[model samples]
Target: MQCPLPRIAVLWSALLFGLALSAGTTPALAQAERCPKLVAGNPFLQRLAPRTVPAAYVAPRQVGLTYIGHSTFLIETAGGVTVATDYNDYVRPAMVPRVATMNRAHSTHYSLNPDPGIEHVLKGWREDRDPVHYDLDIDDLWVGNLQTNIRDWRGDTIRNGNSIFVFRAADLCIAHLGHLHHTLTHDDIGALGRLDVVLAPVDGSYTLDIDGMIEVLKSLEAPVVIPMHYFNESTLENFLTRFAGRDYAIERRESPELVLSRETLPRKPTVIVLPPGG
Candidate 1:
């Protein structure tokens, strides 16, 4: 997976600059304490084993994920905390989410009138204000973000205009690539910590190119990668074709939902293709 060095260099540079100007979401240096990181380095990186080895045995600590079409997903945590990603007027979860995360790349990615019942509305970008950062540790879940830049409608760079939202729960971390526009930098990877699962935009046009998106996914080294923000089936298939017999196994599921747990992730790095509209 070779990319043009010059293009990558530019993308990396812009992100570094964005981080410098952005304020207080993640510490500058990755904590000496890494998040259950490094599949090879830390024994804790391995998923917590289930109580029994029975075929039907389920993990005690688990998260339920349902794809709600486009980039929106309904994430239900064990403690009854519901989270909606890329919450917008066009597509939303059935019920109001306790927490909502939105990106401003397009009207479809955000809403002007989000539900007032939402306990926490995490806006990924702000206009004429410093980028927003969050470190919310609540019942059964922890949410944080690393800031990144995005391209506006006219193709102008908006500094600190996007965020990579990370949700930590039940000894696993999941990241959503909110309208991500560039390949990640070394510092970006370090700050993001270990990612067991990633929700990525694979449109290869509106977001980062397919190559760069794949590059970002590989750099994070998450065992589970799920595709989102694709408009049509062909677009989704094109992204899957690139990985067909390569680094990741492709699983096409009939259901557009998943139950993720440290004990239940596939042993191999896999691209789980959940159909849209759950």
Candidate 2:
């Protein structure tokens, strides 16, 4: 359900969720960083290279992720849990997602009138400056948020206006950076724990600059990195150029969906280019 966490509360959603909570970069995230139930995001821990998404949903120990243009992505878990990241009215999943996450950057990043079918709606920002905490554990999936500040069009900063949603599924930990405006801090990286996959924004000016975003990715050290939120091929290519092919093996996917499992993860860090549109 509908779990309205205690206002001004940190990782205290136990009343409804009864699971440990994490809200983007808040002190509460340290809890999830230490939770044993969460996935250990080490792609190299497995053997063969990753596999692709099949027509059928993923099997146990596998997660299917589909990019729905812009910053939205549909995350499917082994237990049939569906999570829509950066969910907005303009860009959304073909089918209604079980959980919808939104940021306060703009209308394109969130929807005021979300579908009632969505069982959980996690908003990144609050009216006050306090960061929002969400620790939703249903079936075999766990979703949490890391709140970060964003710069408005007026060049002013909105503290905790954006969030980086983390999804722990099967044996993979996937992170989606939502409307991120700046580089991360030391504490920010520590709270994120280890990430197996990262869906990052590559539009230099609108989001973080290419170099800064690269630093953030390097810090997370995820084996697989997917590019999103870029305007055109030029910008995406520019960001890809920063990574040396020797260290990061770049691959292009024909489809927008990716089926990932610990046993199929890459041996080294890879920057995957998934076809745009879900």
Candidate 3:
């Protein structure tokens, strides 16, 4: 007998969840913590260790992240919610993400016209330059953001001009550095708490200088770092060279997608490079 449309959709979602779990991408959804109290001087920042991967990437406990060129990443949570980071008019993922987060450091970081179908549209900067505070629970995921400053066309400071979006799902905290212009502050670090994964810009000249970006990454101390906003191979290579023989382990994935969970974070810090997706 043919399955009903709704039944078929559910089955497909379940199947994907199972596959993700088997791939070590499982998230302990129920155990996932809300943003903990902000604290400065976390010990984890001083240590780098190797991590053990779960069996494979599977769902419910794991999430699938695909790089969609520039700084946009399609974050697929185990709860069937999808988020598009740094969504802009220039480039976007093929799939319609449930939520879209934008930063306005440049026109490329945001879209003037997003799909009306998207349930939640998050803008990192406000007209008044006040902080863009986002804390919402969608399905089984909790999404939040931290305000940061950015430089405008005339090199003037725009307070709260950008945001670092945080995704809490499957017992993991992932952050996307959106059009980041300067090093993070102590208060920003405290607000972020702990992060398992970070999506950062390595353009060196445009976003944060290579050295300054390195400093920021070291402070966050997330186990996994994915580089974005690179201009070309030379820019990427230049960034990679800075981490040579450092605490970070560099791995270039075959594709623009990665499946990850808290359990699979490398024991030592790692920088995994995924090619831009068109």
User: Which candidate achieves the best lDDT against the true structure?
Assistant: 2
- Which regions of candidate 1 fall more than 4 Å away from where they truly are? 1-59
Residue pairs in clash, model 2: 24-145, 24-146, 24-147
- Residues 1-278 of candidate 2 have per-residue lDDT tens digits of 11133531443333123222323245544444522233344343222323333336788789999988899989987667788888899998889888999988878899999999999999988979776777766556677877788888999988788878888877678888999998887767766777889999998989999889988989989999999989899988888887655488999999999999978989989999998788
- Summed over model 2, clashes come to 3
TM-score of every candidate relative to the true structure: 0.81, 0.83, 0.80
List per-candidate RMSD values in Å.
8.3, 7.9, 13.9
Error of 1 at 81 (Å): 0.6
Comparing 2 and 3 by lDDT, which wins?
2
lDDT of 1 by residue, 146-237 (tens): 77788888998887678788887667788899899988877677567678899999999999999998889889889999999999989998
Higher-ranked by TM-score: 1 or 3: 1
- Off by more than 4 A, model 2: 1-25, 34-55
Could you arrange the candidates by TM-score from highest to lowest? Answer: 2, 1, 3
Candidate 2 overall Cα lDDT vs. reference? 0.77
* TM-score: model 3 vs. ground truth: 0.80
**For candidate 1, which ten residues in a row score worst on lDDT?**
49-58
lDDT of each: 0.76, 0.77, 0.75
